[model samples]
Target: MENGSDIDLLVARRLQALRTRSGMTLNALAERTGLSAPYLSRLEKGERQPSVGTLLQLARVYGVSVGELVEGRPGGDYHLLRAADATAHQGRDGRYTVLSGPRAAVSVMRVELPPGSRSEEARHAGEEWLHVLSGRAGFVLDGEPVVLEEGDAVHFDSGRPHSLANEGDGTVTVLIVSTAAPTPASHPMPPASREATPVTAARRPAARDR
Candidate 1:
């Protein structure tokens, strides 16, 4: 039978494994869980035990239950997610915070781009949608550039080259959701419109973004 120390070790190992599998560094996990990096480091090393609140917060950030955190077993289908629990990171020209889902499959992220920042053109295998929550953004799709304002939404094939830039004076925030697996290409690209149609509402906010 496992002793109390062994259980602690198992919990630590599971937490560390989850963080690594999620492609998060200690600093990244700290940013997501709102915990100090040093404290997380100690927790991972089994040198310290986290409070119940801290454990619950970490579990939420990892998309797992508190039982999973302690028992080293997969929890139920229910996932506890919160917007404040996302992992934030600084990219080349902007800052991004993951809102929900997993990077390994379908993922959703909240992105903030400062004025004058431009993202490089790139292509992925999946499909993606971007909704402007605040400010305005300049998006380039298939060599064409268009300005998107608050409430504007765009959906496209990720296989095509695309980029995003912030031309407005203030910061721009967008909710971007994508699937890692490739999807069949059906409709062609549509003209850029100032307003997002109501049909796009079918893609509701992820559990965490709210």
Candidate 2:
């Protein structure tokens, strides 16, 4: 894993690629995205971590999903990204790496949930498949909490409010593939609350090492 920097240069490259593929100059893209040219330029250069909300806006303008904006070549008979090329992104929610180019039907992501950290509560249209790759964590669906350990996996509808938490003392890494609807195509985003609120789970027992 490339963890030398917080900036995900892969996202930077992909953003520039998508914009170039559409034959749009930075100025044109700025006009289309309603984002200032300088800010967009920073995003393309990996100088700033693009927030989920910002990615949503760019996705709509590029006719793609937030996942697509962070992935590899996008579409083809097959998609492959060398391990060294994978970019790790640090976000308000947590650290994640896009595992594949967003498909017409699904988006795959590898997420890290730090101990005592909880992701923002979010609900969207469609379904989700989650597999715990390491450590133990809590997956909250609506108001119920389900504890999962390494190798545990679950698939469920994503329509109900849901969030993930690393209630244990160690971080949990999960592979999430979702076919859920992204922020609606036209919902206005509040700059103040870029990502919904992240709720901390009540203190709980830490998972013992395997």
Candidate 3:
């Protein structure tokens, strides 16, 4: 069986690999994980140990099971996502990392804002939901500013002019899910090609000795 130390090493390696595969900078991962850049850097370097809650949060942000995060493999149907596999995009005001789902019909993203980042008023076709996994944030939807805290969830029409901001002293981490099919103008794939692909489960590895 894998010892606790072995599991810790695997988790650390997986975290670094995922972030690198996603092309996420340390700053980007920090933004996505609601952790400071320095802290994230330390974690990646194995200089710091994360709390169980922190590990779980990172797993969710990467759309991976906690077991995958710790074991460097999946425990079931889910796949592990790393900060390295995300496509990072930035606007004039805010930054976001897009973690595309296996299917193109939906997209998951991690968004981060500086203490007061904001976006221009714009609208799109579709619906979006934001779940605040950590920190505090505020959203301006159609001119109304709604504050959100950790564990808070909000859903809104993408066609409405909306913007977000970090309302607290630190950064805000939000898991954004978009339920819009990729459009021809935005995505080149056909509808049939946008469907989710099944991920086969793999056997769990034997635990290593400590």
Best by TM-score: 2
Q: Taking the candidates one at a time, how many backbone clashes does each contain? A: 0, 0, 16
The superposed Cα distance between candidate 1 and the true structure at residue 43, in angstroms, equals 25
State the lDDT of candidate 1 residue by residue for 1-210, as single tens digits.
Answer: 665567567777887887887788887776655567998988888877554335434655665544455554333454455666444444444666545432234556677888887776655444678898998788877676666767878887654666888878999998887653312222222333434232222223442154
Worst 10 residues of 1 by lDDT: 182-191
Question: What's the distance in Å from true for residue 141, model 1?
Answer: 0.8
Each model's TM-score, in the order given? 0.51, 0.60, 0.47
Tens digits of per-residue lDDT, candidate 3, 1-210, equal 555456446657778987786677887666655567887777777666654334434554565544445444323454456766543334234555555434434556676766866544434445667887777777776666777777777786654556677888887888877655434321221122122222121112331111
* RMSD each, Å: 13.8, 7.4, 16.3
Worst 10 residues of 2 by lDDT: 188-197
What residue runs in model 1 are displaced by over 4 Å at the alpha carbon?
1-76, 182-210
Name the runs in model 3 displaced over 4 angstroms: 1-80, 83-89, 184-210
What is the RMSD, in Å, between candidate 1 and the native fold over all Cα? 13.8
Q: How close is candidate 1 to the true structure, as a TM-score?
A: 0.51
